[model samples]
Target: MDIATYTAFCLTAGPLTILMVIGLWKLFEKAGRPGWESLIPVYNVYIILKISGRPWWLLLLLLIPGINIIIGVGVAVDFIKSYGKFKISQNAAIILLPFICLPKWGFDKNTRYLGPSATISFHEKHRKDLQKSTTREWAEAVIFAVVAATLIRSLFIEAYTIPTPSMESSLLVGDFLFVSKINYGARLPITPVAFPFAHHTMPIIGGKAYWNGIKLPYFRLPGLGDIKKGDVVVFNFPMDADSPFYRPVDKRENYIKRCQGTPGDTLSLLNAKVYVNDEAAITPSHGEMEYMVRNDGSSFNRQLARDLHLSDIQQFTNQDFMMNMTAQSAALLKQQAGIKSVRPNIRFNGVYDPEVFPHNPKFRWNVDNLGPIIIPKKGWTVKLDSLTLPIYRRAIEVYEQNKLQVNDNHISINGKPADSYTFKLNYYWMMGDNRHNSEDSRFWGFVPEDHIVGKALFVWMSWDAETHKIRWSRVMRMIK
Candidate 1:
C-alpha cells in the first residue's frame, strides 16, 4: 500500500479501535479480571473466551481466517448473556454496537457479572424459558448456515460461471470455476450488508440486493502472492462507475481476464503480439483470435468447422471467410483441401480506433497495435499535461475519488493548482485472450487495485449448452 492509502486507513480505524479497547477494559474489571488484560492482543481473546465459559481450545479457532468471524460472534453473544442481557435487541447491541453497549453495561450501577453463560448449570436453571419450538430451532439452523456460507464465499473461494466468449478457448462459456480469494488476498466486502449469494440484484424480485447506506473502506488480508503477468483474474467492472449506472466498487459486475501487464511495466501490442517492457510476453497456448481465410470458391465444410472449434464464422464472399480459432487450429485448417491462405486479421499501426483506451486522435492506437504506455504504480507521480491527462484523468478523478479540472491550459486537483499527480493505488492492464471479441482494458483503461476480486483457480465443472451435454475432459481442469 502507498503512504496515502495507509494514512487514510489508520485515520478511520484508530478511533474505532480505541473505543473498543476502553469498553473491553471496563468489562474486564467488572468480571474481576485486570482491566489491563483488554490492552493485550491474543491474550484479550483468551480472556473473552474464559469469561464466556468457552473452552480454552476455542482460542485456536480464533486464529483462523473465515472461521474466526463465526467463533468471535458466538463468544460475544455468550459474554453478553453472562451480564444478564437476554433480549434479541440486547444481543444485537453487543455484537453491532460493542463500543457503546459494552461500556454502557459495564459502567451501569445495576449491571453485575452473573456466572458464565455457557456453563451447564446456568443453562439448566434457565431451561424453562430457553425452550425453543421446532420452527424456531429450524430458523436458527438456517440462519447459521447462511452466515457460514457467506463467510466462506467472501473470504476463501467463490463459484463463478463464464457468461461470455471473451476468454474463449482458454476458459469457455458455461465453465463453472472455483475462484481463489486467498491467492491474491481476500478483499473484505466494501458493501457488507447484502443479500446472501446475490451479487448486486435480488432474485425473483428486481431490486438492489445490497444496502448502500453503510460503506466500508477497502481492505484486504495478506495473500499467498501478488498478481503476476498471465494470471487469470476476476475483477469488478470499472465502467459501472459512469453516469446512469453508479454502482459501488464491490457491487459492480464481475469480469474475468488475463493479466497482461503488472504495475510499473510498460506494455504494448504490435501485430497482435503482447510485449512487456520491450520483451515478448508469454501468450496463452489455447488463446484464439480472428483469422481471414480464402478458399477456391468451393463450398465450406460444416464438419471441419465443428471439428476445429471455429466460432463466429462469417463468409464475405464464396472465396473469402473470417473465423475465430487458435493458431494450432488455423495451421490444421491451412492444410485442408480448397483452402488458399489463412492469415491473422491484424489492424495496421497508425489506424485510429475511437473505441480503444484514451480515445485520442493523437495516439492512433487500436486493439492489435496499442501503447508502449506505462502501467501506474503506487506512489508513481506523472506530470499532468494535455497529452497525459487523457490517459490518466479517469483513474485520478473517478477511481481515486479526486476533484480534477483543466482550465486555460492549467491543471487543478482538489481545487488546488497542480502540475503533477501521484497515484494512490497500483494499476494493472488486463486483456482478453479472444482479442477480436473482448471489451477489456484495451477499450476502458486501467483497473485499480480496489476493483480486483480474486484469482481464477480452476474449472470445477464445464457444460456445453449448444450440445446440451457436459464437457467431461474440461471438468476439474486447472486454469493456466
Candidate 2:
C-alpha cells in the first residue's frame, strides 16, 4: 500500500514497539536489575549498553550524523551476544524491528521471567515477559496518537496563518485556522524523490522538477457551488504555482472580495453597488458574530470577519443605489473641491448618471459594493462572438483554454487559436464566508475542479490575527 494508506499500520507499530521494549525490560528486571532503569532516557541507553556489554562512550555515536551507522552496526553485533536464549543477530533485529520478537519467542528456549510467555519468539511471548505493561501500553498509545496527528495534519487539513492585511477585517492578518482537503477528497500518495515525510502527492510537495515530471491520473470529487458574491474565499495563488518557492497565499497575503458574480451569472458594476440579475444584492450575513449567551454562551455567523479599513472605500454609504449619476452630477463631483476626478474603467466612463449613484450603497471597488458580472460554467456553451473579455472567457483560458494543433492550423484561447479544443476538466469558484475580505474567485478566476482537494467543514480552534493570540472564545466552535 502507499505510504498514506499505511498510516494505520505505522501507528499500530508504536504500541507493539513499546510493548516489546517493556517486555524485554521486565526480562532484564527478572535478572535482578531495577525495573525503573527502563524509564529513564539516558539511563535506559546505559542499561542497553550494559546489556550489550558495550562501553558507555559508544552511546555518543548516536549524536553523530553518519557516524551512527557504523556504531549502530556494532551495537547490533554486540547486542546479539548479550543473551544466549535470544540468538538472533542484533543487526537482523535492527533491520527488522517489526519481527524482532520472533527470535525471542521461536528461537529462544529460555522462559521469560516477568510477563506470561508461551514460546521463545516475541510472537509466542505473553504478558509474563513484560514489566510494567501499562507503561508500555500508555507509551505506545501516546506515541501512536502523536504520529497520527502529525501525519493527518501534514497530509490532510493544515493550519494556515494570515500574515497580511489583504484579507483584513474578515480573516485578520494573524488569524489562525485550518483548511481541510478531505471534505472534497484526497490525492493518492506519491513517494518522494528525497525525504520520507514528503509523502503528499500535491505538486507543492514534489518540488519543481519533481512536480513537473509527475503525471496524475485524475481522481475527482463533485464540484461544489461557485463562491457567491460577497463570500470570503481562500485558494492557491495562481502565479505562485509556477514559482519554485510557492506557498499558499494567507488570508492576509491575498485579496478577499465578495463574490460579486458566479458562473453563468451575469455581473456588472453599475455605479458600484453589486447587481445580480438586475437586482440589489444582499449581505445575509457578513460573518459569524461572537456573542455571550445568557449567563452561558452562544454564537452566530460562525464565519470569520471584522469591520476594518475596508468599509470606507466608497462615499454615500447611506444609500444602497447604483450610480444615480448624470452629466450634472459628474460635473458637480468633478467641480467639488478635494474630490478626485471620476476615474472608472473605460467601459463604464460617463455611464454613471449624475442623477444616479452607481448600483446602490453608493458604488465602490471594495468587496462590499462591486460587480454584476457572470462567471462561466461547464456543460454550458456560448458561441464565440457572445463571449467577451474579463468574464466567462477569462475563466476558460485559465485551465481549459490550453493549446493544441488541429491538422495544420495553430490556435490559442483568449488570443491565439489552436487546432482542437478539449475541455479536459471543469473549474470552480471558492470563497470564504467573510464577504468583505477574502481572496477568492474574483482574483484567481476559478478553481479548476481537478485541483479541488476538499471542503472546510469545522473550526476546531481560532487564533487572533493581529496579536497572534489564541482566542479561547472560539474553541470548540463549529464552522458554518
Candidate 3:
C-alpha cells in the first residue's frame, strides 16, 4: 500500500486492533471477564469502561470531535487506576505508549491485577521502576513528546511570529502570536510525513522538510466557528499554485491579514478604503496609510519619527516626505512646527497595474480602486464569460481542482462546455492594515477556505529589533 493508504489504515484499524487483542485480552482475564470479549471492537470498549469504573454513557463523549481526545485521556487515566497502578509515571506511560504499558501491565508475572477496591499502596512497588529510565525508555519518551506536540500543534494552537510589516500596527513584525486552530477548524496536513517541528524548509541547511511521495486530500475537523469579516486570519499563500514547486496548501508560506470580504460578500476598494457589500467597512483601529508630507524645504524630524516609532519613513524629495502613519500619528506629525501639509497618498482610479489580480489590461484596476467582485461561497455558481472568467479562473482551475480551458469566446471545464461553475470551496478576500506596503488578496486573489490556518489569538512575546529590547506593553496583548 502507498504511504497515505498505509497511514490511514494504521490510524483506523492497525495499532488499535492489536491493542484491543493484547492489552485488553490479558486485562479482561485479570478483571474476571471473558478474554474473547476483547476481540470485539465496540464490546471491548464497554468491557474496558466497566473495568475502569466509568459509566458506559461516557462513550458518547468519545464521539465528539475534539472532545474525544480528552475522553480518551480520561479513559486511560481510569484504566491505569483500575490496575492499581496509581503512580503519575504509570499514568503518563499509559497515555504516551498504551501499547507497551497496557501489555506490560497485563502480562507481566510480577504485576498483579488489583480490583477497583485496590489501595494506592499497590503502586508503591512500581514507582522505583518508573524512576529508573533505560535507553529504550528515554528513546520512547522523546518519540512520545514529538508525536504529542505535533498533534497538539496541528489541531489546537500554533506559535507564529510576524516576519514582515504587512500587518503593521495591527500585528507587528516582531510580535510572537499564538494562532488558534480551532477557531476556523484545523486543516489536516496534506503532506503528513514530514520532519518534526519544521515547516516547509529546514532552517540554515535549507532543504524541503516534507516527503511528497504521499499526498492526502484537504480535510478539516469541525471547528467552533467559521471565519468572519474584520477578523484577522492566517492562511496559506494561494499564488503558489503553479508547478515546479507545487506546495501543498498547509506547506505554503503563512500570511496574516484582515478578512475584508467573506464568502458571498461583494468587495471593492475605493481610494484605499475597503467596502463590503456596498457599505464602507470599518478599518482596523490602528491601521496605517501612506501620506505625502510636504516639509519646509528641509529634512523631516527624524528624531520625532523615531520617538513615535515610525521606522518606515522616507524622504521622497528635499521638501516632500513619504511616510506610513496611522491617523493618530499623522495628526501628531501635522502639528509639528516645520511640517507644511500631510495628505494621504491615494492612487488615482482607472489606473491599471500589471501586478494586480486578474493581471489583464482590460480590468484597469489598481490596489486602491479595484474589485467590486463577489467572493465565492461553496455551492454558489457564477457564469463564465470573458469578464467573469479572469476574476475566478484561478479559484476554479487551481483551488477547486477543475480543468479549465478557454478557446476564443468559449469556456469549457472538465472536457465539457460549461457557461457557469459552482465553487467547491468558500473564498475570502484578505487585506493588510499597512494598505500601501502590503501585498494581499487584492494582488493575488481570493484565499480558499482550505488554505486557512487559524485565527491570530495573542502576542505572547514581542521584540523590537531596532531597539534591541523586548516590547513590554505588547507582550500578552490579545489580538483584535
Candidate 4:
C-alpha cells in the first residue's frame, strides 16, 4: 500500500476500532465477565462467542478473510439479542453503528443481561416475542443471501464473461470465467455504495448503479504475488476518464488483456513481435494475427475455415486473401491443395499510425512496430519534456490527480515549476493477444495500478454462439 492509502486507513479505521473495543469492555462487565478481556484480540472473540451461546469453533472461521465478515455479522446480531434487543432496526444499529449502539446499550438503565440468545432454552422462554412470520423469515433469508454473495464477490472471486474477441483463441468469446481477486490481492471497494449484482449500470434501467459521493482511497489486502508478465488481467478502462464519461475509478468499464509490460520494463513491438527489455517476449500458443494468404485462383472449402477457426476473411482478388488465424493454422493451410503462399500482414517500421499510443506523428509507432518506452514504476522519476510528456501526461495528470500546466515549453505540476516528476503508482502495459484486431494499450497508453480489478483464473463454461452449442473441450479450462 502507498503512504497516502495507509494514512487514510489509519485515520478512519483506527478510531472506530478503539471505540468498539471500549464499548465491548463495558458490555463484557455487564455480562459478569472481566472488562479487560476485550483488550485481547482472539480471546475477545471467544468471550463474545461464550456470551452469545455460539460454538467456540466459530473462532476458526473468524480467522478467515471473506467468510469472517459474514460470521462477524451473525455474532454481532446474536450478541445484541442476548441483551433483550431483538428488533430489526436494533440489529441493524449493532451491525452498522456498533461504536454508537454498543455504548448506548451498555450504559442504558433498561438494558439487562438476558440468557444466551442462541441457546434453545432462551428461545423457548421468549418464543412469544421472538417468533417470526413466514414472510419475515423469507425476507431475512433473502437479505442474508444478498449480503453474503456481495461480500464473497468483493473479496474472493467473481464471475465474468468474455464479451469481446480481444483475447481471441486463448480466451474465446462466450467464455464464462471465474476471475480470482485474491491473486493480485482483493481491492477494497472504492465506490462502496452500489446496487447489488450490478456493475456500472442498472439492469434494464439505463442509469448509474453506483454513487460516487462516498469514494474510498485505493487499498488492497496482501495477495499471493505481484502481477507477472503474461498473466491475463481484468482492469477498468483508463479511457473512461475522458470525454463524456468521467466515471469513478472502480465504475469504469472492465477490459481484459494480457500483461505485456510490467513496471520498470522497456517494452516494444518489432514486426508484430513483442520485445521486453530487448528480449523477445513469450507469445501465447493460441494467439492469432492477420495473415496474408495467396491461393491458385481457387475458392477455399467451408470446412477448412471451420477447422482453422479463421475470422475476418477478406478477398482482395480471386487469388489473394487476408484472414485472421493462429500461426499453426496458417502452417496447416499452407499445405492444402491449390495453396501458394502465406505471409504475416505486418505494418513496416517507421510507418506512423495516428491511432497508436502517444498518438504523435513523431513516434512513428503502429500495431506491428512500437517504441522501447519504459513502463512507470512507483517512485521512478522521468524527465518532463516535450517527448516524454505525451506518453506520461494521462498517468501523471489524470490518474495521479495532479494539476499540471505547460507554458512556453515549461512544465509546472501542482503550481510548481518542475523539470522531472516521480510516479506515485506503478503503471503497466496491457495488450491483446489478437495483435491486429485488438484495441488495447497500443491505442491507449498505460494501465495505472488503481485501475486493476483482478486476474482471470479459468473458464468455467464456453458457448459457441453461432453453433448454438457448448464447447465441451473448453469447459473448466485453466487460463495460462
User: TM-score: which candidate is best?
Assistant: 1
The global C-alpha lDDT for each of the candidates, from Candidate 1 onward, is: 0.90, 0.43, 0.84, 0.90
Worst 10-residue lDDT window, candidate 4: 114-123
Tell me how many clashing residue pairs each candidate has.
0, 72, 0, 0
Weakest 10 consecutive residues of candidate 2 by summed lDDT? 288-297
TM-score of candidate 2 against the unseen true structure: 0.44
Off by over 4 Å in 1: 1-19, 39-42, 55-64, 84-92, 107-111, 117-119
- List model 4 lDDT by residue over 436-468, tens digit each: 889899999999998999999999999999999
> Per-residue lDDT tens digits of candidate 1, residues 388-433?
8999999999999888988899999989999999998999999999
Which digits, one per residue and each the tens of the lDDT, describe model 3 over residues 271-292?
Answer: 9888888999998988887888
lDDT of 2 by residue, 1-480 (tens): 224425755676667766656755664565457867766776776776676667889889766533454466556445444443333333345444624553354235574333222123443444465444677578667755654564465346656555654433334444565665444444333212323223223346444233333232334322334344554444445444334544322101222333445555665444434456787755333331111111111221112112222222332333221121223333444453333344322223233322221223233333333344444555665444322333333345544534322233333553665332333445444444433234455444555544443334434566665567787765554333
Greater TM-score among 1 and 2 belongs to 1
lDDT accuracy of residue 183 in candidate 2: 47
Compute the lDDT of residue 265 as modeled in candidate 3.
Answer: 97
**Collision pairs in model 3:** none
Model 1 TM-score on a 0 to 1 scale = 0.93
